[model samples]
Target: MGLIAGIYSIENKAIDSGRHLDKMIQCQQHRCQGGEPVKYINKQIAIAMVNPLDSIFSEYDIPTNSHNPISGLYNGIYAFTDGIVLDVPKHKIYFESNGLPMQDNTCSSIVAAAYQKWGLDFMLHLEGEFSCAIWDEKKKRLVLARDPFGHKPIHYYSNNKKVYFSSEIKGILDAGVNPGIDLTSLSDFLSLNCIPYPATIFKNIFQVPPGSLVIINSLDIKIKKYWEPVISVDKTISFENAAQMITESLKEAVKRRMMAKDAFCFLSGGMDSSAIVSFMTEVSSSTVHAVSVGFEEEEENELEDAAVMAKHVGAKLHQVIAKPDSFFDMLDLMVFHHDTPFTDTSAYPTFYAGKLGSSLTDVILTGDGPDQTMGGSGHYVFAVKNNIFANRKKTFQFLSGIGAGIASALSIDPTPALFSKIHRKLYRQSLGPVHAAYDIRSYFPDIVKKYLCTKNLYDVHSAHNPYRHPEAWFKQAQGLDDINKYLYADMQFYVPDDLMIKVDRMCMAHGLETLSPFQDIKLAEIVNKLPGHYKILQTKNNQIITKYILQKVCENRFPEQILTKKKQGFGVPLEKWLKQNNGEKIKEILLDPGSLQRGYFKGKSIEKFVNVFLENKGDYFFPGPNAIAGLLTLELWHRRYLDFI
Candidate 1:
């Protein structure tokens, strides 16, 4: 919702140039489109903001506060807060808020009512999303914090003495910090679709994770988590009451998300999105605008469902028919925009869909978090049926089949062999104890970790949170399904940090704000208490899906065909794209010996992968690693950023 930028000298640089900082802050000016940028600079400290509060509010029944201008940045709207102050030499604090306060003088109020009581802990008590920074000049330190859910991102860089930080990565780069590509993050992207929190595609720079506050002092940098989802299982509620609570909570979550000045919804014709659009219509008096992207050759099932929902709710619908040519055209832009090697083929359409949405509104509401938070995929079914003792037996059988298939294929090439081997390893991990909540994450193999990353570094990264109580999550479950544990871990880690980060960054990249209704903390708390049956609802052929409660609340809102349709997820033709048109270019980037000198990947394995993909016997197109896509994306990123060729 806001941007922050500052540079502190380790050796007291005493430099006072705010122009670059202003340009950096201006990069996010779309976040404050209806207003202008506010800037302040002094020796050893600087700050820039896009908008200042209003000039008058008495007519609106909102209280007004007197403005104390810092070096002459006046309060405009007067009711809200936006402006930056840097009193570095004076050992004082400079602060601003975008649109949260009832009065201007209440900046003092945050100290008494919020900061003093909790100290840095005050971040948890905040209701709205914001990025805040304080320079303790006397202490020679800086403190930065983001809201608990990471609705905002803060980035920083330090060189022993001086520390520079900002809300956007581009801000730091504009400040003249070296913006080197972090191939480690690219590896993570290939493993997980998005960059993990605290690590961006940029080397040596990091984003502050959500629900976290970081302190940088003469001593060291420290980060602490203030909030996480805990298992609060209440088995007492009957199925009927649980259903009702979930229905009401979800409705309320959607209602709160509708408070934007302008809003649009991503429609996928699935239960989550359809339900969101339906409730949005029921709650709002305004006409809702819905946007969707579809393949020209894709089945019209989703489009029909989307059309039905739009008609049912009388929403203004806009569809972008995605032709193969369009994907090919935007390929470079998508790679450059992400600035990392992303393996998620769906990201292509998501980017185009976002482009379509940003053309209309500054805010877009999405249905990305619910599936993982609730029981959304085949993993949930596996969770339900998994038995630690019995599943291990099944695991051996599955592994044997995988092993036989790999061995009989008679390809000693380590790339495909390692690829298939790690998959079986994940399935083995998935079968572990039936209660390792981290299975959802561990589902992706650690090929890079095994051979690429060092034992010490990989151990540090793969080490599970010691605070996590796997037993507590498992004990809360009435049924001992492996899915519940997986869901618990996903909700705990992946939902807030990974999935939420992906949607937020993609939308914000185009200056579009995204509101995650499903990430409503209250709604997640309530749903966690529901019975297993209510969550799993009508498992068929061992597959589980969602929204049993939604049927009761608004049965007519979704089309019958959509309800019965198999889930055809958002996927891109990466292999098809590579093979049909750009295969040689992709293979060259990944298999090139010159590229191997980058040191993030094994050279030999990559060559084999390219060879096997060309032969079409690797089956690399599914839910596992597609080496060509990962390598091509990284090469594209390298070309655009590091090499600058």
Candidate 2:
């Protein structure tokens, strides 16, 4: 819910760079823990912190990066940690952590605790949604780190001689220096909806992977992953012990997050969200408030389901009526806060939900990690299904060749060509790497791929860009089965980069703090390693079930109807909205010649996609709608970031 930025130089050069830090901090001043006088250590290091504007302890603006005996800026280390720290010393150290020890933990105490326990490795046990940094006075080094789940982000750029770090990417660029796009990451946005670890949308600048720490001392920089999303079984926990284990873990998770004053929940009317609401109601001492977003489009609306959960929990439900007009209208603001474009139709709703919830409380618990941890995504099952038919790849390829040969000789033109294309696609999909399967499922078919025209895609760096072919991520899931491998990718790539990015930026944009009990490190470690089948089940009646263990735990908690209910997650009415007014909003933004002239896309190709979208044709690629959505987001981003600059 806040931002931290600072500079560390190789040469012990006095930095007049307070200007850069000030400008960067000002960009995210909403989380201003107020301004502090700049402190320099031996003229080589500088540190700054900004907390939320509306924090209760507004007077404690200048966080504690304590002064040592040698000089006031001891070690010249400056630190900013967001999210309440669970444990710290009883008495005050560097900066007053608002009040009494454990109850009101400040970023100062959190870092101070790390200094005490792990020395430079403070990020390891420093749990919760936090991005923290420290300057080791003795070693004359700077360390930057992020939380295990990456709900909070920390990005840094090293220009060989100096290292620049920040809580958001724009904070680094706003210093009047645009590093330009990361030439290697051109297709990352199109395929994954985000850039992977150690890489940002901008070049040179990089994000710290979740569960990792980066250290810089006189330009000798090293980034290490202290933790990874590795799934391993706990031998003590048997199949019969799972239910109670899940119950206890949830209880503790809720207790930790609900520690804040006046906490609330966002009820999505789905199992994940409703379960959070139900848990909070039982564990919280006070009345828990719930917020839900309702769409005018009946198919996209879930107010009734939310109401059902609200009544069950006896919580007051406040609904935000989300309309297409409002969602589109908020694009400029979203791009400004996110500093990047995301096309998940749910982004706008998540934004509106946070805006609504911010009115009720500063901290809201969301259900984000269940699908990632418990193998709940339908894609996991689809990957499994693809594997089942993998053995038929060569057989299908031979038949496909025969069909094309016969059609060519008979003078059947497109029909034979189309058959060959489909056959090749199936063969590739069935036997391709899991990550390849994952990407292709979301990729526009190659026939329509000419629509993308970015210069970076054809450049020399393209081959090295792991995103072009994502075997790197799949290969990392070495020991897991096909389903778990896909789940691991979802956890490592999709959850942190795409889903977490949306939640963090949108919620924080409104000055609200979101904590996910499901994403808690301890809870994730326990559930993620469970047997893959325990997470997903194919019932005797032919139904595919996800989060199998969780559903069993909630079987008696929610109504029977909820147990059998369809999976209705947080989403927008995009398909229907595009059809509204003959897709005028889309036409006005995406089909505009000026948009195509940006050199990122071919004008005619976009027109064809738009026409196909309007025609409601299913033969086109699945990602076509998403790609079309990204085009609007990109154009809007240009208006706010690139063009404005």
Q: Would you estimate the TM-scores of all the predictions?
A: 0.77, 0.88
How many angstroms is residue 470 displaced in model 1 relative to the true structure, after the best TM-score fit? 11
Tens digit of per-residue lDDT, candidate 2, span 350-430: 988998988887778998888888877767667655453243456665665565455434432111245544544543443
Q: Quantify all predictions' global Cα lDDT against the true fold.
A: 0.58, 0.69
For residues 460-533, what per-residue lDDT tens digits would candidate 1 score against the true structure? 44563221334444455435444455576566445645555556556655656666677676787887665556
Best by lDDT: 2
Judge candidate 2 against the unseen true structure and give its global Cα lDDT, from 0 to 1.
0.69
Q: How many backbone clashes does candidate 2 have?
A: 3
* Clash number for each model: 15, 3
C-alpha lDDT (0 to 100) for residue 57 of candidate 1: 15
For TM-score, the strongest prediction is 2
Alpha carbon deviation, residue 145, candidate 2 (Å): 0.3
Runs off by more than 4 Å, candidate 2: 32-42, 52-77, 87-104, 234-236, 386-436, 443-447, 454-470, 618-623
Residue 543 C-alpha lDDT in model 2: 62
